[model samples]
Target: MTRRRHPSLWIAMALATSSLSGCRCSEPPAEKEEPAKASPTIQRGDAVLVEPNAGDFFEARVLGLEPAAGIQSLKLQRSDGEITTADAVDVYKLPDESAAAAASKQPGLAPGRLVICEVAHQRWVGCRIKTVSEDGYQIEDFGGEEHRISLKKLMLPSELTRMNLEQRFKIGDRRRAFEREAARAGQPAPPPGFSPGFKERVIAKRGDEWFSAHIVRFHDDGAFRVRWMADDRENDVAKVEVIPEPPYQQPPKRGGFVLLKPNVQSLPWARWRVVSVRPELVLQNAAGEQSQSSRREVVPLDPDVAASDEESP
Candidate 1:
């Protein structure tokens, strides 16, 4: 929904008199100036979803326009024939078919005819039309609810469906672009399922600051085209660099031998045989010397190496 200023207010003015004897009367009595009136975002006959109550939205048609509490309000009728009012900011417009999409429809279907259209996969529903023209057609269902369906859907109902404006920009044609980004950002994809173009936190290489970003496009070589989630700057950033999180590789099992990294003595990384389990790792060298070290110092065990024959089973 588009947001703009509410409607202006009505101000009572003082009586005005023609300037007489070269003297301005009353210095144009002080009056409160009216605020600038915003143009209505939704039109009289637009297809929109209106939120009649908080968190509850309903599909409705704009029947009239009026001012409600110094704001632009719309009179709408729902599919179930309920008439209610809502502010312009609460109206969401459905997507219109692009020029390329309209040309692909089946050849000769006129308005005022009852037709069945595929609303979803393997689902067909009946629709009635108000008027049809080159620009667009107004339509309603049996329940009298209006919708902005693509004209192309009326033709090849099997292969086509109504494309929403929000879906086109956020969820269609660029789904993988978002996934590759979530991978790079070290953020998990939504557990339930994928949401295309959803934003997640990413550390920027520039300042090393964490910022919200998402993929807007994808390169052939598997790089992300990113967009900033920052409200001040919604610019698209190409090829956002992401640092991979360090893999959590566990050390060798306590009963097994392991190697430890060098200590402050500048000693080399050493191979040690695990002698016992404790808060600190107890290790023995091949020389029959035992050393105490932090469990974290042990490196991962080599997959190709077999257990040492020196084990005390």
Candidate 2:
């Protein structure tokens, strides 16, 4: 029996088959894989901002690595003066220092720029190179103490290394360049150490917080342009906001006494002599050989006390 289905039934079956085919054509396409991103390199003594989690960032200084834990492990000193530990994977260099220029394989290190070098016991200290030679680098630390640090131990700040300290100061706005020249002619000169390129700790008005920065240039009235290296920020801070951090190497007058560290491994309390002040505060004992003390470890004795120490047996 060539019994055929109704014409309507035949039409329904045809439509059903077409719909199934269309469903297959409408299937979603596979997604392509994205390329891998490169990770940033970080090392000890570099300034960085760390991210503990999503959206939270903290400013920190890299103390060093804890290889026993992992290559990614690091010791950090926070902006608030607190010392803590972190992971290298979680830390990132500042925008201006993203290239890790200081850590590069190139050969370029000059004097007068601030650099972080590994000091005694692998301690990282911020210092300026007084002299660079084939022998080694003579590092003048923040405390004004001098050290003979190896070239391999130095971590040159990318910005400061490539650019002189004077250039880093954002002197002014559009008219600042011309204004500086005009003002220099007639205005009373700023006192020494307050002039351009003087590094000091500044107190911010926003949070009344204290941070290290350097004077860029002096303004007509009393304002001074300053550069904050921690975040690569520059602005004008009032004279009042700027205060000098007394360096430990102040040379006292002849026949006068100054507080000093008794031994390389001792606390800074012993009263020492005033051989000369220029270049650096030179102190000595009955024995010869120049010794250095940290600014934090040294204190100045009042003239009255200094005189008494000198007169003492």
Candidate 3:
């Protein structure tokens, strides 16, 4: 039946319906959250720093990965050609570019300077600086291989000389101690040339290369401990690896002119003519004064200098 509904009641019902619909439309839809990105995994042939049992991290190349005892391990090869294994957790990948802004600056270090650098196997060898980098220095070794070395691994010639002198002094002290022990024991003096510090220079052969070096120790087993001049590195060498180097290679020739310190009391060297070389170097000055001297006491005069000396009254 079409019963007349109250106007107020109809309006209230309509408003109630509108309010419910507006409330439903007011809320925005819930959004879906994205997952966090994961880091790139380590792969083969990547340069990484690995820590071994020594607890020190060094540069190495990843050879491959292996599972040991249910834990992942990486096989790495060091710059020294040594292959080792470390847990994946101990390996860190190296960045393409160094994070440091600039390399540490040091005195006596510059591009093109010759230095001794520690490359493979912690062995120091001669290298030339190519450039500076935050990691260290870019250097080319004598073998033409390029490597980045830290500052502590680099040594200047002067610094190496200083170190060599210090090492020599230490060796000399040891020699003195040995001598004192021999004296106390009523033993005869150690054989000459068999003692340390016996020679100032020696030709030392190391790895197919002959180097000028100083004797650090002469062992009872006939082995020699020599310090190389090229890098001031000490190495134990066999007896055949070392030999005394004469003070002078070529002695003054007969009839040649030389600057000679005639005697131990002589303070300054004087120009003289070489009379004889064999037996001993006999010299005669411009005044016909004759004297005997060792090759080390004389400096050979250049041809031009000798000619000028002759031309002079």
Best by TM-score: 2
Error of 1 at 290 (Å): 44
Weakest ten-residue segment in model 2 by summed lDDT: 304-313
Q: Using lDDT as the measure, which candidate wins? A: 3
lDDT of 3 by residue, 88-157 (tens): 6545454342221121233335687665455875354556788976667898754457898776555443
Clashing pairs in 3: none
User: What local lDDT does model 2 show for residue 161?
Assistant: 25
Error of model 1, residue 186, in angstroms: 16
Candidate 1: list runs displaced more than 4 Å.
1-58, 62-70, 81-83, 88-175, 178-247, 250-313
Model 1 superposed RMSD (Cα): 24.5
- TM-score of predicted structure 1: 0.22
Clashes of 3: 0
Instruction: Provide the global lDDT of candidate 1 against the true structure.
Output: 0.42
* Tens-digit lDDT string for candidate 2 (184-210): 322111224533335544322213334
Model 3, residue 302: displacement in angstroms? 60
Q: 158-274 in candidate 1: lDDT tens per residue?
A: 111122222222332244443343234332112222222334333222233334445556566645555544442444333434321111134445645554544432233345567
List residue ranges in candidate 2 displaced over 4 A: 1-105, 158-313
Q: What is the lDDT of residue 241 in candidate 1?
A: 43
Per-model lDDT: 0.42, 0.46, 0.52
